[model samples]
Target: MATIAFASSSSGLLFNKSKETSPRNGASLFHYNGLKPVEAKQFEAKGFISTSVRCKTVKAAVSAPKRETDPKKRVVITGMGLVSVFGSDIDTFYDKLLDGVSGITPIDRFDASEYSVRFAGQIRDFSSTGYIDGKNDRRLDDCWRYCLVAGKRALDDASLTKPVLDTMDKTRVGVLVGSGMGGITAFSSGVEALVQKGYKKITPFFIPYSITNMGSALLAIDTGLMGPNYSISTACATANYCFFSAANHIRRGDADIMVAGGTEAAVTPTGVGGFIACRALSQRNTDPQKASRPWDKNRDGFVIGEGAGVLVMECLEHALKRGANIIAEYLGGAVTCDAHHMTDPRADGLGVSSCISKSLEDAGVSPEEVNYINAHATSTLAGDLAEVNAIKKVFKDTSEIKMNGTKSMTGHGLGAAGGLEAIATIKAINTGWLHPTLNQNDLEGDVTIDTVPNVKKRHQVNVAISNSFGFGGHNSVVVFAPYNL
Candidate 1:
């Protein structure tokens, strides 16, 4: 399904590459027969216009006044986007996962000769030029740039546009894109710039660009969204927390539509040094490709990955009214903490289990109903087994559980894992295939859970649970079910 918009009002005109026709400098009215969907709003004047496009297989943007709707009605994921060391979309990412690809590569962005862990799962090939114009690109921090591009990709993947904003109230739109440790690149660059040419050499946008919220703020402003805007910074568990917050907003009727995800581009000096200082990163400098071996007996530490993942979430009523494409419904989610430590989870995995259990309970679904689980297995010794213990304790008929760790390919996407894993789960359900937990040749430690390995396998899965446990004992679980009317 392909649809484009070109509206010219009595003033100025803008257009998207997808536009089919050029209208004179006058306001053009767009009328969508099904769910008004547009890519971009290029017009001379600003006024809400209702135009709809119904994606036969997938739903479009928001629509007419939402009539009667169920509060507990399942929430479907209409759109998804990701930017990792792996290729951008589900297809590329899944292929690498099934093939046991490792994102760890030597630190090329900066000379890592002095660091203990020189290899990280850095995004090496992205030009960023295609997504951001050269002039504005310099103004954005690395993390924000990643978020900006990822967010736009998600909207495009969902076949949504700025013109579709007319169907839904702009005030009801929100953005929550958490960056676990945002603008580290900016801080590094700014310091270098300062030392090279004094304080005057630094750009004014440094502060705004470096903060995590700038990415989310810019996203909302760009799309004219203004509902429940905020950012979460729970380290590795950032995206899970953002999605959980966004879901709560929708359920509470704070906003009808929201964009939730996380981004991280912390492949800089401070980032590498900080993690190394904590002894939390992998030191497989010679064999970077085989560094992140989850569930493997010889795994050492996590391979730091850099990327972003964004999901567009709409209120049940709003989505139903628009007949929006429902990819997978987010049944429910929850967040918890161990309160036991600042950096490590309790060996007993009590908080993680409580979060998983409560999330299933909140969604009102049985653990047996969950077919596939996206585990928070970072290949780190203690953390990996702890998450597995948590999952084993939460579900029923646990032996039949099919679990995969997407981080195997994307590297540990840090905060972005929550939403990136969502992309994998949705694709898994939509395509009826389970991506493997890359680099897992042998199971290790006291964990005895099944690990999907080596390639893509087709399986009929209904519900998928994605887990993310961040630093500070933060734990979050998101439940996604097959989109059913």
Candidate 2:
């Protein structure tokens, strides 16, 4: 008979010594001499029980979870590109965020004067000149157009243009850009044409360009990539879902590189009108910039925003083989659903807390390691505080963790929100700065954590989590950290 000894620590379970009794019939088949014994009296003094042979007391060693060390399985961010209200450049976008610049403005793309919510974070004068042909550009929906531009720019940033692209196996590359209200502009136009001029007036491109998956398909066509190409429409959580899936494709050896993230250009008449119909938008027309105030006591609702954000994700083995510049490491991620409500998160914050815990577990990290959080924080009365509560539930100490809401400045980019925030998270890790949650005049009492209100703070981030929860109760959390050899 053998007795295996185990010790329970605050960290986790710790294995101690195992002792075997005298063999029956005075015959011993095996002699195990590798284990070091601990004195039972010493262990008892330290509150550790000893069920096996003991000698001298020794402190139990505590171990932390190790991140994925295998190069072939590890995922890294190589490049980033975005079409934001601030601009199309990644640096310019992050700079605007860090400065607490508000991108929200009066919705002039269409006549939003009649709507209750008259303002939005709209992208004005956006041109995909170098990325798409003029002819195709004229017909493509803004959602698809933004996806193409962002995806191509990401590839270019990764140095995957012309000669470099030609030398590589295109089949090993993939596109996974997702959108929430996919091609709303195109769909609205098609409906208008059908009602005014009948079926004959409906353009043949209506179906092809209006679907959500078209963005990923179009990017693949333009880039000649033959790997896993698709779109996930999880509302605002679409981008993180795409990132998670794309990284898995690389980790599974289905692809070497993935152009992934989210694109959303839903700031059309219908898009605005729909949110207004649901009473989910801020009606602060007098001051558009101050409308999106996440964690503020006076926040009415989230201000609608639109844009596209893309990242070039590659396996570490493939990235190092090509000498790619690693921006940050995609440690891990997780997705969950509330299943309680359609447009609102659970009041108890169970789903979100569980999702965050799972994300940390998947990332092989601890709550103590996460110092920064890019919150969904869409400024709605329920959503903003619900997320904060959820965060507080997962992270016991709010003192070390600093969280900021990008939607406070950018006004909630819908499907593109997660992608945009992910870039912001990585930038914070890289530059040692965290953007401010703007318009945070009167902070909510429940928000015990530092929300980084109104100004950027210099923070050397160890690990960061970007959160995105969507209208359908979709919850997603992605973990990122600085790349280390």
Candidate 3:
């Protein structure tokens, strides 16, 4: 019988054929190459009295996995831009959320006194003076204006100037900004014009501005990016889907940088009436400020919000080569569909739970490692509880994890919700403070997890997940972590 000498090190296991054997303490010594002794009975049957082999010490060389000179290509966020009701600046948006300020107010764009739901998280004092020409701005929808501003602001935040962009390969950049209800205002107006006067009354810019892909198209044109450009309209999950798709684009080497996020300007009269007709909006007309109360016992429904959120995502190697500021690393993300209801969450929460589990797996993280969750709780009765139940299924003890609902402050941005909430999640990682889920005075009975209710909590977040579920049973989750480098 031949004996095989084995040794182990940080590199890997090494094996050699030798009559003399020497084994270090705690090292597995085997009689044959590529064979491991499984049980004590097997060892005794082989007449081996000791677990350690007796042989002369020999330095056996074996090939080991090569370490990467630069870390494997990863997608990192270099800049974040958002146009919330609070403001467009990222600091201002997070400051208001940390301060527990409610952006919800009575819809002043039009007379909403007759409507059951009279308020929303409406953007006020928004101006696209420098970003778009006055005539073009007037012709375009607010969704287009918001997308342009936010996308450009993100590029600015990333320190990407016209000269800098020109120096790089223009074909390696792309835009994926999306909107749930693109140009609702323009579409509504065009329909009204056709009904009231004639076909000639319809503006020529109507089709260009009303389509969902126009935001990304205009962004690409403005930036001279000839790479991949498109829009994903997955209801409230639009932003997360865009993020996931954009990350995959970078990973697959299709683009080195991607301007990805979501935009929405559905606060028109038609938009308000549409949500009201579906009864998906809160009817708490008396207290508009407290209308969005996620995880609260008296919650009614989500408050419609209008804005855009955009992020500059680049391959880590590309960002480092350009000396760009790395905000955070996009660990991973996943999307799934319930295939159950068009407007309601699945009663069993299988879709959401599966989506979350798959996202963690995609991020290469364990459930216990996740400490924070930017919940998709939209203040609705079924939606909030359904998400909670789904989370409970993923995590065993919820005490270690602190979750909050940003919708309490920004209302539901619909397609833009995921992008804004993802910014909040990354801000929490950078700031070590988790914002509160406001108006959570009375907690739901089944929800045992800490909602971080009504006040900011200081805690170090190592790993966080942002959840966004949309109408049509679309479920999306994105995991983010602080960049070590």
Candidate 4:
């Protein structure tokens, strides 16, 4: 049933009209009215407006949330692919995360002794030997290389090989991979050539390879997917935005399948130097592994990471017809802008809180249903607390909701962060084990909620929300749950 909601200033309340439902524990899940204007004033001192609904009780049993019955509108993740610091395989990457193995290491690709930050979660010895042709493999930027390999790997995971793909309708498939710093290496090299040598020294492939949409375009061209193809460049939130948009395309009947996610290879000299100039990188060169401590009071800044994560998203009917293995279901997602700062998050965190609320409403789930959160905790002082504060506004009792930070082990992957984290969320659903947020010594006072610190915990996640907030106050949240037949 379609949900309908109404709000009036005179009434000072918003109420939802939907079917009443009960959880596995036989406790009634009430659709409470939205927060009143008086409740909104709670955030006045923090510099933004916010509203929230109160939950009645906390349930312990894990049960799947309401899913769309219509096959065409229902979106499922058939495959997940990633080129992480650990490796290119999904199981290996997730296993490392669950084991609390830190991937951050000293910058060895270039001379970085003079820089403030000398370490990152850089992918060492990445190769596209079998994926791309010899000539194009060497010529393409790492950003392009990462996405191409990840996207193709995702198709393989979906069981859509060359012979299988040939039988499917090519026009009904699409690609929507994104990158925040698109072709930074190529752009930097082209400019260096123009400055040091001359205009004649510039490479002819500079413009074509340096644009943001080239990754998506090339993936489509290589796979022969002729439907909706484009890229979103919303910094850290790029992957979730792509997933959200790609799922909607399937829901709207524009496409039957999509290769969607984000990629970023910004571990180059220019990328590291730019973050250093902005003072956004941690200089804990002595302890690079423990540098990305999200809720730790000793954290100075975020550790840079680079890689790609892609997912093969398909409609339910399409998957059933082909006898595909479904990984998880894409419930709903929402994006919002803080409209407050370029690099800094809003002190009040109303933007993020609102985005989470909207995502839950769209998913036809309540705050009580979400027992896990893959938070966008980047180990920065203000960012970690701001995200936690925002989360408190939506979830008053986090005692039931366990939140963790993926950046603690992998560092911040910028555009690729959301895609990597989403894979972690789905893994948690399938494995019933939540990875620990490492290096939680001297925890922040305001962060009282359980972060599952230092060790993995066995917990059945009913509904999980993965958040990715970026520069320019772009906030995004995507909901995921186990796929049940």
Candidate 5:
């Protein structure tokens, strides 16, 4: 019942003014602690009004209708969490985004003299120790930490604590989260301790804590989820793949509860130097804050970023039976390969278009119904143009689609890109606002649709998609629809 402030948008809900927020207005329907029901309704005939000791107020009702096809297993988002330079919630993040405030700064995670681009959009104030219990922190890596905090926050937000699978039937519960580059930081540190110091100094838990899949595995361990555990690697599309696979799992009824999302912590010398070697990073070192200017005329390349995004996906009957909050619906997803190049997309965007078409089919929605699109506009010349062309192909009529990218604000998060963008899409649905492409000074190349630029625009978004195409010709698209039932 503590006083808290919250702002809602089609994009997402944000509690920016305060870090720890009171339960939202609608949580009262479930655990408001403000009301109690009487077993006997016969007294109602005597005009005796039922008393509710709880003071919580009902602000609004959430109505998500179940699908007639299969009622028990509709995919619904119960909770979401985000960690970026933009702030935890979507609005705080979008505010920093619209102002063109880049989180990129001088490399502070580690020394980077040899790396051409040392600056990155790193979460300087973040600490994994806080995400994990202090006692268990030593056994976890940066990747696991990011996922842990975000995942914990999501479960809490959903009003569902980590399940005690041992005490309950957990075969229906699962977890899946990916990292574009996981444990690279831990790997770098372990090698230093092993070679420079001594093999004895190396921790015994190096490998499990450092692998990409351990983040999700640790989530399962911490929360006691025993359904499924897996990690996916797709360079930058890692999170999208996680979301895609999670949606499919729900569709197949493989799991009723799937903790899904992605985390990335690859801003070390290995992460920065390797990308620089590929000539894929921006070199606006003089102006680090403005370096990540996506869809801009002067865009050099992408700015490295590190963070995580997490979402709690549950089947409709499960959420309804527990009276959990429903944030959004995961329509479905699609994945494809370019088969053209390892690090470059096809010039004509043939593969990208196919990915979009496939995702639309998976979601059972048409391109015409898609109102907003979170593009993989990393500010690169070929990548930007190619994706736009692909959008044109799949959308058929680009004039109606509202498109933009969050990278201009948070920088390219490599593997975390898809996960963070998915959070952005959910925020858009919550707030009904779409961010303008910051630093896009000019409408260059071929932009057919309405690319919101310079300022944030508010509009209704019933169905939206987020695109993440990573290196090795990996392309992923996820579609989310506002729950109608």
Candidate 6:
């Protein structure tokens, strides 16, 4: 009744080595059946110890196949919401993008005239009338306010009212709203209070509102969702990462519905000064509207923006059961790291290319199937062309894929960029139109892809991918397709 087992020693396999070896070098091990040293050798010589166990284990470990899941449990976007510079309305946001309107304007919230970069895609006169209460609104950061507004709106868009949500299991709903720099204004103000007045001057709500996870926590509290609630921060790639992670939660049956996206409010003095120090802002002070020119030769740097974008995602089965308004299908997505540079992308474009390939593989789509790409070109000289190189590597012909830089008009929303661009991608698929990349008069290099420059174009989009990369070498790509029964 001895057990047969396999043990490893410092020298080699237990059966192959001498049993009398010192403990430092190796130890005499027994099989699961407690075979003696003599019996183990007899079994080993008969190929029981080698081919029957060791070789098979090594082979399985080296060449295991990836498990494929049923595509029927796929996730789909039931609704989309955003608090962009354009407005809280999704139609208004998409319409403004179609007209090639630049949201970049002078930073008038505070005196930024002396700063090198003074313009941003700032949202003015934002009101959370019905979304949040007045007392909490005044106490919370703009980041928290945006999340509360957008998350509730997204649920509304999905037709998931309070009554309907109460009928369903609250534990099956989750929230995963992320941010790159959470509550910058609150953090800066807290620090100033600690320096000038005292720690006592700081508000008690500072810690609760300043953390990155507060956005998701607030959304969950407001909606009473008791499921998985968390935040992901990967700089600019935050939104796409959230979408990818949230979709998997649904696919894995952990949750039936997920409110996922990214929010940011980094338009304060410290936010601008930090980017200015890194020389990552455009100094086109004369014309703030044209400051964010993505592929143009005169492009300097990205114009920082602030906003939140949220998507109400549910499994196809769950959506159909709930009779949700289906918008688009979340085919698949992938995330990768460059591991090359801290602030800049890898010059070789390997990270981006691999990400795109893996995304397509996950979506079970081909390169030719993707007719459009919402490019992550943030108007930077190096980043703009580097993404194009990676796209070219993925789609060799380039003629079939019409890529556009939405950041040209929206500027760089940082953590919320992917969420906003994801909405743009889904909108483009729903409506048969593609927005232009503003201010592309003089192309930067041998750029052959038609950027849909200067004006919107009417095109039928079948499958599309939205690309978003971050400062810390994080690259993410999400694939979307028209939802069809």
Clashes of each: 17, 1, 4, 0, 19, 7
lDDT of each: 0.71, 0.80, 0.80, 0.82, 0.71, 0.80
Q: Of the candidates numbered 3 and 4, which has the greater lDDT value? A: 4
Candidate ranking (lDDT, best to worst): 4, 2, 3, 6, 5, 1
Q: Which of candidates 5 and 6 is the stronger one according to TM-score?
A: 6
**TM-score for each predicted model, relative to the true structure:** 0.82, 0.87, 0.85, 0.87, 0.82, 0.85
Tens digits of per-residue lDDT for model 2, 1-485: 01211111100001112322333555322222221221111101122222222111112224456678889999999999899999899889999999999999998888877787799999988989989999999999999988888889989998888689889898899999999989998898899999999999999988888899999999888878898988999988899999989988988999999999999988898998887654567778898899988888887777889899999999999999999999999999999987754553444567777888888888977776778899888876656666776777776656778899998888878899998999999999899989999998999987889899999988888889999887667889999999998
lDDT of 5 by residue, 354-421 (tens): 78878876776655567789988886645676676677766554555788988877887777778788
Q: Which lDDT tens digits does candidate 3 get at residues 1-485?
A: 12221211100111334533454554423322321211111001111122221111111213221211333358899998878898888998999999999999999999888987889999999988777888888788989899999999999999987889999898999999998999998899899999999999998877888999999999899889988999999988999999999988988889999999999999889999987655567778889899899878887677899899999999989999889999999888899997854554444567777888888777766665577999888887567777777787787656668899999988888888888899999999899899999998899998898899899998788678999888667889999988877
Cα lDDT for residue 221, candidate 5:
82
Q: For model 5, what is the error of residue 476's alpha carbon versus the real structure, in angstroms, after optimal superposition?
A: 0.3
**Candidate 5: residue 351 lDDT (0-100):** 69
lDDT, candidate 1, 1-485, per-residue tens: 01221111100011123333325634323221211121221111112232332212121223322212374444567788888787676578766765666676788898888777888888877766556788878777778878888887877666667667756688888899998888887777788899999999997877877787887898887777878898999877889888888888888778877789999887778887876654566667788877777778777677777888899887766776776777778878888887854553454566777888778767766554566788887866556666665666665345556788777766677777777788888788788778777776777745665677756676677567888887667888888877666
- Give the Cα error of residue 386 in candidate 6, in Å: 0.6
How far residue 415's Cα lies from its native spot in candidate 3, in Å, is: 0.7
For candidate 3, the per-residue lDDT at 244 reads: 95
On a 0 to 100 scale, what is the lDDT of residue 171 in model 3?
93
- Model 1: weakest 10-residue lDDT segment is 5-14
- Model 6 bad stretches (over 4 Å): 1-72
Model 3 TM-score (2 dp): 0.85
